[model samples]
Target: MSTAAEVSQNNNVGPVMRQGELAQAVVEAAEIDNPDKIIKVEDKVAYLRIQTSDEMILKRQTIEEMLGRPFSMSEIEIELASFAGRIDTQVEYIRFYHAKHL
Candidate 1:
């Protein structure tokens, strides 16, 4: 076994964070929604990645159709802007994750 300094002395220095957990979270969420796309979350952040395997883009496009009327571009912008402002005003909780090497 070698210390991080010793490892870094010879090879690339930093530890790599694994994406399995994030991918699993996204897959789980997609399965629950029965989405046609393969969805994935990025780590613990409020981020998502969706791969359009099937005609999954249609599912997203249908949201407006289901609502009967389409919202104007300005209306959508205003709603999203308000949501962002509300999120910015809220308190955020953080937790530390410790990784154990074997």
Candidate 2:
């Protein structure tokens, strides 16, 4: 079995959000903001699992554009059911990635 550290080293990361409009907007935003990476979404009835290789970033601007209104990064916590890898959040963007060993 792979340990957490071993798994994290693979660099797969993303957000698992509750099934709703907010989750939908996140999916669209992730796709737009990370065009260089292949984004994958899995539906689990209750939530949506959105993932990407190496790293994934969701910009507030892109989400706001998808939502057609103002958005706050703090609001994402309400819909975030879980996540993979480490997360770095800012007022303008949220990033999911594995911390590289130096």
Q: Point to the candidate with the largest TM-score.
A: 2
Q: How displaced is residue 38 in candidate 1, in Å?
A: 3.4
Best candidate, lDDT-wise? 2
Instruction: Tell me how far the alpha carbon of residue 3 in candidate 2 is from the true structure, in angstroms, after superposition.
Output: 13
Error of 2 at 89 (Å): 1.0
Worst 10 residues of 2 by lDDT: 3-12
Q: Across residues 40-61, which tens digit of lDDT does each residue of candidate 1 receive? A: 3333333233322222111222
How accurate locally, in lDDT, is each candidate? 0.28, 0.90
* 3-49: candidate 2 lDDT, tens digit per residue: 88776456568999999999999999999999998989999989999
RMSD of each: 15.3, 3.0
